[model samples]
Structure formats: structure tokens, C-alpha cells
Target chain A: MNTLVLTRNDLSVIVQAFGRDALMDEVLAQLRIALREYDPSRTQSLRRQGFVYEKPRLGVLEWMPVMRVSRQVVIKVVAYNPGNPDDVGLPTIVSTISVYDPATGHLVALLDGILLTALRTGAASAVATQILARPGSSIVGIIGCGAQAVTQLHALSRVMQIQEVLFFDTDPSAVASFPRRTAFLGLSMKSAPPNVVARASDVLCTATSVEVGKGPVFEDSDLKPWIHVNAVGSDLPGKIEVPLSLLKRSLVCPDFLEQALIEGESQQLDASEVGPSLSDLVKRQQDFEAYRSRPTVFDSTGYALEDMVATEIVLKHARALGLGRELAIENILADPRNPYGPLDVQASRPAQDRALP
Target chain B: MNTLVLTRNDLSVIVQAFGRDALMDEVLAQLRIALREYDPSRTQSLRRQGFVYEKPRLGVLEWMPVMRVSRQVVIKVVAYNPGNPDDVGLPTIVSTISVYDPATGHLVALLDGILLTALRTGAASAVATQILARPGSSIVGIIGCGAQAVTQLHALSRVMQIQEVLFFDTDPSAVASFPRRTAFLGLSMKSAPPNVVARASDVLCTATSVEVGKGPVFEDSDLKPWIHVNAVGSDLPGKIEVPLSLLKRSLVCPDFLEQALIEGESQQLDASEVGPSLSDLVKRQQDFEAYRSRPTVFDSTGYALEDMVATEIVLKHARALGLGRELAIENILADPRNPYGPLDVQASRPAQDRALP
Candidate 1:
């Protein structure tokens, strides 16, 4: 009943308490295991419908269900309405996660998924990099410098010996200071043009949501063999960040094939070209050596189950440190003695009187 | 910048301040306006593949995306794994809501959808009944007296004149005390058989989450030709209470057809038998009149846009009455005054250490 409400500071506390590297390292571990728990047969794709009375003539709703067996968590998130990115001055997508105790079905914790989303997305890229990238790939190119960009560097640093970072944003000045932060991480950073970063960096990460529906970011000519590409930007219908020709030529692997086909860069490519899931990689993992020889595409449109995994990790860490503010948002019936009756609210009279009578 | 965290007590303050009737009226108004803003061309299901990671061989991740309009809010709620009912003695679904300020692309509020889900769900049912139910019809028959049943009555009391309510729950004792709470609304209550209550009441509501796979509760033969059966439980796959035969016989109108088809009692019958959407009732303006002559079915499967409406209402009222608690659960950059690049925790080490360490 005492659910801890972790503040933004708590997340920062955890980041500082456990080095960011250690956090991303653990996050990837948990996510990898979470991926293992996915059983296509057991999962459910929920339905949604709403009333639409105007132009465009459609009301919408969505339901997604996921399970992380190793972590013992199941996650579902519904993003409803034709939420516009321009209207909110933020990502159109809004999310929240419910962490439950699988052993007892007890509702455990509820956390903000926006940050979790940015973290897990970056962590997923780091995960793919850990499995596919050359071990000492110290130089990295981050094509987008938005919210997920910061986390990408944070998570990647946790897994690889990230000695240098190259940053690019449409507004070059927006990310001119990337080098300053890397200095604290004991790494140097530079501002580079798209080609310079893509051509010189050992690993490439695309984290732009704006790239959706425009065109591919890189052509086959831009990518280097053995250099891994982590595409985390576009994750919706008609969204693709990497060109089909580039994807076809690369040793492609996706977080989930069904997903990549619908949202990832693979959405545009022939189904045969998109490659297998991380599960496939785990199964035929012996070919890990082959990753070094081929140009690799790590298409990561984030997974919601990762939020649950990250939530469990956050809860576990928060509980261990005894961090978080506890507040009761759900009204617990005052008269627990009357199990079948309504919750009493007489105390609310004072507020009403102060405002009205 | 200030998000008030409204606890159950706060919710009580909310109701007391606005008065239950006022709240119901406001919710209905909001629901109508919400329906007016939906646009189908703007919404394609949020890509589910990206968020779900099927367990290695067992489960999958689910996140649904539903969009409304250009100026309105679109939301995604993650209702992770539902707790096992018997083992946990709790509702299986736990969820949260996120409201986006699309103009600035900023995530404005991360809310407790668990609370809003129940509130909005009950509010939505009341809207349906207010517009669809017969005039002056008060006495009610509730098929299953679960958690939603209590809210069902509370919501109806605000919209209709009722003097009595009869409930039928598997656990007889569960409904034994059901009548007392509604006593304040000038109503008496009791436990009665489906046939008995179905015959006596002018308006009947079936609220059991249990369905046909489990077995039907009442046949079409049990319904009074004049009764309005508000089916609120058959909203998920594998959950149905009203028999398909009842659906065939009645003038059925659904909150959302696509949803009811897969989750409602309509699922038991072929898709052909399910009637038009509730909007169609609004469209043709005939459903309300036709129902007066025969048993009417308001197939109520919850919708996300309604949640958006409810959230918008609760939040508007919550802010006006100073309810909700502020949560500092979002990200905090090191330099709050002038944040740049990835957060440098080291730069803010002094501040954090001063606070804790």
C-alpha cells in the first residue's frame, strides 16, 4: 500500500549512486533477459476504439501487453489520441509504467515512462553495441542531440570504452557543448558534420524523431563495414531512418522483427531484408564472430517491456537505498471495516465550505 | 510547474467542492466535446512491435497508440500484467496516464490512471446512460457487484432518479449490504436473483468481469422488454456477461464497435450480429427512441479518448480546487539555471553531496 514516488532527483541520485556506466550495464542486462521472456503466443495486442465526430472522422485507442519473465514483470501501455508533437513542445508520446509483483500479483510501483523511455532506448542501443560492436570501439557518432541522445552516451559509456564522441543536430549550435560533458566522463567530444561523424566513428547512433517519414539518413556509401548502426528514432508507421539499400547491405538485426517491419527502418525494406530478432541472435549467437566482418544495422525502435524492466530496476535500487516519497493518490477507503461500501469523505467538508457555503 | 498530487482524500475534496451532480454534468459535457475532436486519419495504431519484447519463449510487451485530433491530447497508458484475481484478491489491471502539452512537445503531467481509469470508466457509463436510458427510470438491477458496481450506482444517482437497486453477485454476502450506501440517494437496496431483479428494475446493469467462457448470467428471456441493460463488464477478450442472444434481441449500441467485437459479448456471436457504434446512435438519433420500445443494450467497453476527456476534466477540477500533489519525478539537469549537453552529475556533485552524501 505504501508505494514510493520517486522524484526526478531520485533518478539523478541513482545515476550518481551507481555510476552511469554501471546503471546502463545493468539496464542492458535486464533488457536482454527481458527480451528472452517474450513469447509471441502468450502476449496479447489489445484493441481500442473511441468516438470521433469531426474532420478525419476517426477516434482511436491502443493496447499493448508485454512480459519480462526473468524480471517477473508484465507491461502494457496505451497511447491514445492523435497527439501532435508540435502542440506539446515535447514528444507526442506520453507513457507511464505499472510494476507488479509477479509472485503475488501485488501492484508494486508506478513510474514515469518518459525518462525510462529515453533511458531504455539508449540502453537498447548500448545493448546492441555490446553484442555487435568491436570491443574497443572508442569513437562514436550520435546523429541526434535530443533527449535520448544524452542517455545514449550515458548508456554506451557504461558498456564500451567510449574515448571520443561526435555530435550533430540540425542546429549545430544546439549541441556545440558536447565536448564539455564528455570531459567529465574522461572522454573528448567534437562537433562534426554528418559525413565526418558517420565516416570516422566506429559506432553510429541515430536518435532523431524528426527524421520520421522524410527519408533515410544514410546511404550504403556512408556506412563503414564492421561499424554498427543503432537506429532508435522512427518507431511508427511510415517511419524509417536508415535507407533500405543500406539496410539490405548490412548485417541487420532488430529488437523485434514484427516491430521493425512496422516502425523501424525496416518498414520500407522488403520483409526478407530486415534480418532476425535479438532472440534469433541469441539462438544463433555462435555467429557473433560474423558481426566483425559485416556492416551491421541495429534497428532499435524501443520496447515498452523495457520500461517495466527499468522500472523494476529503479524500484529495486530505490528500495535498497530507501529513496522516494510516498503519497496516496488512490483513495483508500477510510472505512476499511466496510469493505463493500463507499469511501467516506466527510473531512472534505471544510474545503467545500471554505470555497462555497 | 506545479502538479498537485490528489490523493483519495483529495478526490473526496474534489467531489464535495463540485458536488457529485456537477461533476457528472461536467464529465458528460467533456465527453461530448471530446467526441467532437476525434480524427481517424491522424491515428494509426501506435506501433506495438517496438514496445513489446516477447519473453524468450513465453510472453510479449504491449503498448497501444490511439490519437484524437490536432488540437487535442493523445495518450498512451501502460497496463502491464494484470494480477491473478484469485491469488491476489485484487484487480488485475494497474495503469497510469500521461498528458502531453503538444504545443511545446513537453510532457505536462504523469497521472495515476488507476484512479482516473475507475473514475472515467464510471463517468463514461453515466454519460451513456444519461443519454440512452429511459426518462424517470430509477430502480436498478446490477448483475455483478464488483468494484465498478459501486461507482456505477454513484454515477447513476447523479444522472437519474433511483429509489432502489438490486444486485446479484456470486458471493451472496457481497451484495448483502449493497443497498445501504444508495440509501442517501433516497434508494433502498437488496440482493436478488437475475430474473427477479431483471423483472423489477427499469434499468439493469451487468457488471461481472466473468463471461460466457465462464457461462452467461441471464438469457434474453430474462430481460424485460422495457429494461435498459447497461453492459459494463464485457470489455476485454475472454470476458463477457450478457448472452449473445440478448444482444441479438436488443437494440444494442456500443461505445466502440471494434473494441466490443473482440471483448464484448458480441465476441460470442459472429461479428455480423453486433450492432452499430454509440456514435451511430448519435448519428441516426434513433437509438434512444427505438430503445423505449424494446430492451436496449449499451455495450460498454471503455475507450481511451474518454480517459483523455476524464483526465482533462479531473485535472481541470483538480487544479481549480487545489487537489493533486506535485511530483518532482521528471528529469533534473545538473545546471537548472542553464542546462546544456548531457547532464554532468560531477558538476552538481557538491549540491547533491551537500543534500545527502
Candidate 2:
């Protein structure tokens, strides 16, 4: 059987054709449905397994695998190289998602996970913001105007009436380019310092690439009492982006608690201080109504379930538009017992002519 | 950047051109070198992580990732479906190997892992047999003549001067087709019962797909005193091919100790009863010479290092022969900070034309 291969261009075509707002809306809706109907016994999502190395310029390669029982398995292999942007002019994260047939273990599709990852992460934050942020929350504050900041703005715009964006970044070029990169959104944008952005908005997103052990992008003093924070950049140990003092008092909900405790902003707080998961909030919105009136934090470490939902939406659109290449990557043998059946043995020379090296 | 995609057809072309014996010989040699020079600090090979489900079918999908410090990362995603052979007309295991550039987290190559897995597994057994099997061994016996049996015989033939082969399988068709499938080897072959095959051999291989709870393909009664058996089929907990009684009296060397304790044949024995790992045996051959004169078992659980070596060999040959397709799978953006730069925005409709559903 042939596996459908979707390149980055194909994914871009999907975004251009379907429109980012519609796509993120579908992702948000599907994520809510997936969370609402999720049964832990049926859907198995594990913490990522990978290697972190310092020699090859401080990077990590991880594999996130999630299985929907009797359905399909989605595995996303992602690499995070902190120095890629300056050293090699590449994004900090590069990834690919592979989907497999559960019954026969056949690879069904392979898609570019770079854009998918950013899109899904944005949708995850939107899911949390819609549930926790106050109604009619319009002003959005963004720290770290990098690649992730655009999607964070776009996704929140889809869920909230994001009319004005106040942003800050350590890099002057990223700060200058933010308005141009997000010009299509047509929202009034302003470049400001961290503390200025922190105190002026009702919903804030921290997506900075702050150096390890030097975080808490802004202090907890000059913030709105009812502002909701989406802490997005603390994906590695010792790399938190939010202040601990802010998290201790707020309703800190993590996307995946087991993973967030190790990598997300929740790492700074004790397990007992952390509130319910995003899924828990989605399942019982009425139970968490009290947290909307207070400061809240959504610590997102990125879960495999988000990738699964994102991949499903991408594949659905790709298949409908007929926008991928189908390649016979695996050897589907006529006789399952003979692996050698696929060899082009006619081209082989005699055994006597070939000797061991 | 482009990723070199090697399909099963491409891999078959490599095997057909390089010759199976020569390829197996090179794999065996490289495996020896890799094991001898292995340092846990530099090469981080983790235990596999995935899911096993028994829903529509009984199957497992696992990702095995290994990273060589300052070098590349190799991940092999494999699926094991016990009902594949009879129910779906596919191999019991299907897999794909992806090689990533550690410096930038760029995927350099994607290769079909069906034949690669079988070849590397056989090479792993040969590495152990060459060190622990008797010198100048001629008679070879094989139990459970399935897909893995062919490679086991081929790899052993590369290390020993085999003149005759005695094989047995509960499946009559597998027993009847064994000789024809391995006709190119030109060795005399006979089909016999499991006990008869076990009693008349200097080296033996057990590659069966026995049920999880129903195992011990052959009893320990009529075996030769100095026979060395490569147990290649016991890869899951409580799924052993060799008898526990036999393992207790013999020196059992596992490919990976920690993994074997959970999934390999070494699970039948206590921690102290098991011998050193295969790498340990390669690193200190002199220390294990005494076991060559007695009954010994090589518990093969299949490690990621083996897959890494196998992938390197295949990529080297593929590069030299120009046998695989190079596709631009990932977006190498000019501006590292703009993920949306690749979108065909000119083709997109106006915002008012596309609204959220």
C-alpha cells in the first residue's frame, strides 16, 4: 500500500486554501470534542521519549506517540535546536508526523509537522483561553515576537475579540518585524517593553526563547487582577517563562500535568498547588467558573493528543483536496512469509564472483 | 533541505547489487566494531516507548531512538501485529527508520525498515555466534522456519561452514517451503520434528512466532552439550521461545540487559543468572571464551544501535549507487523567524469571504 506524503508546501497550500481562521476553528472544535470524549483507557498518550545533547550545539530530538484504540497511531518526531535561528537560519523546531494503520501496522500518511506543531500549540492555548479568560477579553499582550507569536495571536483572535496587540521581545528585529508579519490580521499593534505589555492587557501570551535559568519574563507586580496568561515557551527543564510568585496565586492548569511538571511553568509550583488539566476544564466548565474572576495560567508543554487532532484535520483536508504524493515506501509482499520476495535477484551476480570485504 | 527516501524497492535493489552474503558480512563486522567501541556516555540509546493494544487486533507500535553524541540521531518506528501474517497478508513486523541531523534537527533520510530489521537482527545473532559458538561448526538446525528463519540461516552461514541444515515448524507449509526459499544458499536441507532437529546440530536458531502464554517451542531434553542457540523470537514479556530449564543451565547473553530483563529470553532467569551483554562480550572476548565449550543462549531483543549501524550502511551504499529519491520534505525558510512566509497568500481569498464555521 502507498503512504500519502504531504510536504511543507502541501501544508501551506492547505492553509492558503482553507484559510487559517477556518482551520484553527476546526482544530479548536475537534480538540474540544476529543477532550470531552477522551477515555484514558482507550486513548493512550505517553510522555515523549528522546535524547538531549550538548555536544552538537545543544539540541533535543523527541518522539511523541499516541494511540487511539482500534483506530490509528500518530507519532510525531520533533527536534528542538535552541541555536538554529542564529547559527543555521533554521527554526528552533522541525518535525514530521507519521500515521499508521492499527490492524496491519501499515503507514498511512506522512506530513510536515513544522507548521502543524505551531498551529496545534496555538489552538491548545486558544482552547484554554476560551475556557479560563474573562468574557469579551479583547486586548492581547504578546512577549517574544518570534514565529510562535504569530500563531498565538491568530488562534486567540479566532476565539476572542482580539482588537489590539501589545508585544515585546529582547531582539529588536523580531519586535520590528512583528507588525509586518501579522499585517494580514489587521489588528492595531504596538511595540512596548515587557512590563508595559504585562500591565495593559486582559490576556497575555509568553512565547519567548529565554535562556535557561533566566526566566520569569516579567515580574508579578504590574499585572491585571483578572488577566489570563498562556505560558508557551517553557518546554525544557530550567526554562520556565512565567514568574513563580504569579503561578502560586493563580489557578495554574496544565495541558498535561505529568509533562508540565517537568517542562512547563508548573515546574515552579508544587503538584498540590496546580489546578485541573485543560481536559478537566473542558469536561467540567461549570466547576471552574470561579477561576475566571481571578488570575489564571495555562501551562502548555504540547501534548500528543493535540498533534493527533491536528494531523486528523490536516489529513482530512489534504485527502479532500487531493494534495499529496502517494509513495510505496513499504514492501507489501505477496507472500507475507517471504521477505525476500521483493528483491530484484535477477540483477545479482553469482555468489562466487562476490566475496566478503 | 531534501530527505533521501529509500523505499523497499530501493533497499531490495541494494541487496540485489551488493549480494546478501557480502551485506550480511559487512553488517556483522560493523556491529562488532560498534559494540567494541560503545561508550554509554557518548552514545545515548534509550529503551523503546510506545503502546500495545488489543482492540480490533493485538498489536504494538514502538519507537526506538538512539543518538550518537555530536553526530546524527536514528529512530526506528516498528509495529508488531501478531495477526498480520494470516489475517492481513502482511509480515508480523513492519517498520521505518528515520535519520536526523543532530546539528539542526533536519531529517536526512527515511528508509524502509522491514528488510533492514531482519538483516540487522540476523547480524546481531552472528556477532554473538562468532564469539560463543564452537569453531568450524558445520551442522546447523533451525526451529520455526518462518520469515526470520531465512536471515538467521544466511547470517550464520557467513560465520560458519555449514554443510547441512535440519529445520522444523508446526506449520507444514513453512516446513515444506524452507529449502526453496533458501535455495541460493546451496546447503543441504532436511525437515524434521523439533526434538530431532534440536539433537543434531552444532549451532541452532529459534525464530518463531509462538503465542504469548504458549511458548518453549522445544523442550530441553535431547540437545547437544556444546550447542549454541540464537533465540531470536522472544521479544515480549512472557513470550519466550527457549525453555526456562535450558536457560537456567546455560549462559544466556542478552543484546541489551535492561531491555532483556523486561522482554527478552533473559526474563526467564534471575538477574544474577544472566551473563554479560553482547557489547560486553565483544569488548572483553577473552572473558567469555569459557562459555564456548558449554551450552549457551544469545537472547536477542533487538537494540537501536543495531538499527543505527544498519541504516548507516544502507545510506552509504544508497549514496554511492544513487538508488533513492531525494524529496524536499521540509521547508527551509529564508527567514527563520517567519513560519508563514511559505504560504501562497496571493491565492488566498479575502478575509470576509472565509469566515469561521
Candidate 3:
């Protein structure tokens, strides 16, 4: 038995069989298990991953490595483009997810990291919303509508209740037909400025691929106190989505402190302004539901544990539903043809003195 | 239509349908295309990747970001076990593969990456050997026969003609059973010391997970004239195999010079000995085959290009047979609902702002 391969169709079937509710529950459940089991202080290193753009002269490449420890996984996403992004019709944000196995040699898996960035980014927000958002949060304000914004909506719908959603893209038109594509959700869509939805919605998500020194997307000063924000879009070596001043007023929560301190809105904050990680809040004796009392914030700089959480979710369910294919490509010589455990070695005899043919 | 998921069973079927000979031929064809199209010098730093392994008080975790630039697909593999290997009698290598369509920030597919390592490793060696090794030359010797060793042999059988096979493992049983395991190849097998096998084979493969400062496995005197050794087992930071003196004798070649210089057998060499990389030699048209005359050697550290090669191979075969699963995981809002047009992202004719119901 080996790793099961799940294609899009197989995954679709798995999702249909499990139902969206169960899949989100499992993803969150795995995230908690991974978070509780991991501690950054003990792990060895991050995973090495790559991205191949295969574009003409712009064969851009990105190699990223990450580490997951202490209730979260830390990632360093880099872009490798010899040709400027302006020259080619491509975004320069190249990245990878470095996942750590909480046990053993910590030599767990080295997966396709770029995918981790998308899933974990969305999953982390979903996890936080599960704990902090209002029980029946149906309306969401998606700020900086882009690729990550789509994942935010998908993963959020997986875990929380989304009845109506509002979107705000700089171009305004990207979200024009959001309803037609997401009609499966049966939720009506509204288009508005970031502030309009940020003020009206119970949950707010901001995912913008902004460059460093670029202007902030959402003004923290304007956010309604009860609105739970999922800050995902601004994920680069040096980029920010929500401003520092807004972060100062909110009881900040992050996936990992290290990532937030550098890449998230936390990067712009002084030491005292930074908040506790998601694990810290989740583990506390206080009611996790009380996150809105003090105007809580989730400054997510996506981490590796989210990938672990997502992978475990996929693997566990795939196994149960038989969603994936098992490969013999990594075949070990463990056949019953010979007594000595398939390699044809005699376990009963000295390992060094076997006769050759 | 999206990434087609190929389970080992699917992959096995694909391979069988194509025939082993044809699959190897396909891999060879892919290698040729990869080489012809590859210009490592042109790829940017984003394409270069590594991982972060941290230390925590409770357990160990590794952050692995495995990415490929040619594909724009990144995956993060996570394996977590506090003290798993000895406690559970398991191979402490658990992982997942996440495929993404980065342009739209979509998670195309998430596959189990454990098998990916083995398949990619074999394909990598095959790619290197196909371009570097002389065709019609065989007679092989393998060191450290373990999980990876099996695939190496299978992939190798497809490319070359092996007349005599040699095995030398510290574990005597591993050495003795070589004949039967390789019976399908109809090659000669024997159990001998490292030096003896080093002297016997034309292509010497050092795949043991040995490191520097650990005594060398073989001496320079043990090497045969003109032997092409593929040293792949040493890939991480400090892991290394092969005697530095023998490596020095050969015109060193690496799948990627930048990686091998730091992670390959060359690690044993001081800063002074590091010279031009594998591509350098290729560009110079140096005689890599003159083993006795020049002592040609390839420090076979694997590269990401090989994964791109293997992926292309799998995709080609899967399409030919219509055997893999299709996906809709990526949210590419194409003009039409199909044919992504080679990673093209045309801004949809501006979204019509419509309120969702």
C-alpha cells in the first residue's frame, strides 16, 4: 500500500460523498491536531519546493522552503523571475510551503509548496472564523478580490455559513459575475468598496498581492469592531494589506508570530502591538467565542501546519472513501516469494554472510 | 479540465499500456526535450529552493517546500511524528503533493508526495544518465540497497543493457539475495566488498545515505578506469557518500551544479576544490566518458527539472490512454469554459456588477 493519487474528479467525488460540512470539519479538526502536536523549537528544517512557470523566455521559477513548529508552520515564499513581471503576463509572487513532521526525524513530506500557500491561506482564515466569527455568519466582505480571494470564499463556505457575500476588487469588474460562478452556493452577491462591506459584514476577508511600500488595502480605523478579518492577500517578502494603526486597536491573532512579525501587518507594528498566535487563543481557558468582545483580529501569514492539516484531511478522507490511487512506483522488495522478507535475504542467518548466485 | 491524477495503479496501468520499454522511451524523450529546452542560467532565484528544519521542545518538525518553476506548481509535504520510527516501526517519511494553477491562485490537486520522491528520483537519475552516460553501456553496481534503490534499478533497466550486476551491502543478507531479486533482468549478481564491486561495474552507483567525516565507502584505488558513478544518496545539507579523492579524479557532473556543489559529494572538498559545475563541462564539450583516461564522474544530486520531465511523461501517457482523473479545482475564469490556452490569463470582459440573491 502506498500514497493514494486523487485527481480533480476523484476529489470532486470525495467532496460530494463527504459533503462540504464534513470536509470543513475534518480540515479544522486536523488543523487543531497538527497545531497541538507541533512545536517550532524542536523541529529541524523546512521543506524545499519549487514552481515552474514554463512560459516562453520567462521560464520563471520560484523555490521556497518552510518549517512548521509550535502550533504553526512558518513559510518563506520567494519569486524567481529573470524577466520582469511587467514584461510577461504573470504575477511575480513565486512561493513554497515547508512542512514539518512533529515526530521522528521530522523528515515527513516535501510537497508541492505553491499549492500549500493557497490552501493554508484559506484554511487558516476558515479556522479562525470557525472559532471567532458569529455562529451564523452568512455575509462576508471579500476585499481585494483576486485569486486568493476565491479560495477564501471556497474554504470559508466549507466551514462556516455563507448566505450572502460582497466583493471589492481594485478593478471592480473582476467580481462582476461572481454570482454566476458561485451560484452553486445560492448566495446573492453584492459589489461595494472595501469599507462598505467591511462595515456591514460579520466576517471580512482581505487577500491582495501587494508589493512592499504599496498603499494598504483596508484601513483598520474604519473596520467595525465585530467584523472578523481574514488577511491573506498581502503575502510577499515585504508586503502588507491591513494597516498597522488598525492592527494596534484590535486584539491581534496570527497563525504564526514569526511570519506575522515579518510579512503580515505585524511587520509594521511595534513589539507591544503584535498579538498572540491562533493556538494561544484557541488553547486559552477563556471562551473562544468571545473574540469579538475586544475586537479580535487574525493577521494570517499562511503557515505549514495548515498544509499538514489540509493534507491529513485529504489523506484520511481519501483512504476512507478510497478517493485516491495507490502507486507501486516506490516498490520495496517485500515479496513473499522468498522467506527473508522479499529482498530474498534470510533473516534467520547472519546478514553479512549470504551466498551469492 | 485540470491536472489528471494518476494513482500508482493508474500509473502502473499507464506504464503497462505503454509497455515498460515505451515508458522508458517516453522518459528518454522527455529528458531530451527538457535538456533541449532547459536553460538553468535563465531561471531566477525563485526557482532555487530549500527547507527550514526547526527545533522545538516537545517534538521535531520539518518544513518542506517542493516546487518546480517549469510547471508553476508548488507542493508542501509534511511528516510529523514525535518519536515515530522506533516507536511505530514505520518509515518516518509521510508527505503530500499539492498542485496549483498559480495564475488564478487555485489548488489544482493535492497528491500524496511519498511516492513522488521515489518516482522523481528515478526519473532524475534517468534524465542525468540519459544525457551523460554512454548508451549501450551497462554492468552496474549499487550501494546502499534500500527503498530508492529498487526504482533506480527499474528506471535504469529501461535505459541501458545490464550484463553483470553487483551488490555490496553492510547487511550480508542484502548482499546475498541480489541474484534472485534481479532475476528478471537475467544479469549476473554477487556479494562482494565495496572495492570489489567498484572495480567490476562500468556504471558505479553510490546511493547510500552516508555523510561527510564518516569514513569514505571506497578508496580511489578501488575505482575502475572510466567508471561513471552516480552519487544520489547524499542530497540534504550534510549527507554525502563517495570518496573525495575518487570524485576529484573524474570530471564532476551534477544535475544542477549550484545544488551539488553544496549538497553532493563535493561537500567533502574544501572551498578550494569546488570548480566549474556539470553544465560548465557540458558546454565545454569535455569528454565525460573517458573514465580511465580522464576519470569521468557525475555527482548525481537530483534537480527540479526532472520532476517536470516526469510530470510531462505521466501526462503524455495518461492522455494517450485516457486513464487518469480530471480536475476543476483551479479557478481559471477563462473566456471560454475550457482549454486554458497554456497558462493564459485574459482578464474576463469586465465583470458585470450584479447583486447576489
Candidate 3 docking DockQ:
0.10
Q: On residues B216-250, what C-alpha lDDT tens digit does candidate 1 reach at each position?
A: 77766645667777788764466677766767777
Off by over 4 Å in 2: A342-354, B342-354
For candidate 3, write residues B1-357 as lDDT tens digits.
Answer: 354555546655654454444454555556556555556554332223433333442232332333333444544443433223235543334444445544433345444344344555665565455445655667787886644555566567666767777777665654555556555444567667888888876777776645335646666775556677777676555666777777665656666666676767767676456544444543443444343344555676655555545555665566777775564432222321111111212223122212111
Q: Give the per-residue lDDT of model 3 (tens digit) for A1-357.
A: 343344444555554565443555566666766665556564323332334354543332333333444433443334434232234433333343333334433322222333334555666788777777767777898876554565577678776667788888665445664545444445568898777877777888887655567757766555566677777754444677776666776777877777677667777787677666787766762556666544666888666556556655655565777664544322122331121123222212232321221
**Could you tell me how far off, in angstroms, the CA of residue B228 lies in candidate 3 after the best superposition?**
4.2
Q: What lDDT tens digits, residue by residue, belong to model 1 across residues A1-357?
A: 445677767777776787555666677788777666656555432222222323332222223345434344544342322222233333333444555443433335655555676678877887777778876788899886665676787778767777778878674534764555445455578878777878877888887655335756554565667788888776556657776766777878877667777767777777887676765665556667677556787888666556666787877898899888776544334322122225344312221222211
True interface contacts reproduced by each model, as a fraction? 0.16, 0.53, 0.11
Ordered from best to worst lDDT, the candidate numbers read 2, 1, 3
The CA lDDT of each predicted structure is: 0.60, 0.86, 0.54
Model 3 chain A TM-score equals 0.70
Give the per-residue lDDT digits (tens) of candidate 2, residues B198-312. Answer: 8897888999888798889888997888889999987678899898988988989998888899888998888999998999999999998888888999999889999999999
- Residue B55 Cα positional deviation in candidate 1, in Å, after optimal superposition: 16
Candidate 2 positional error at B66, Å: 0.8
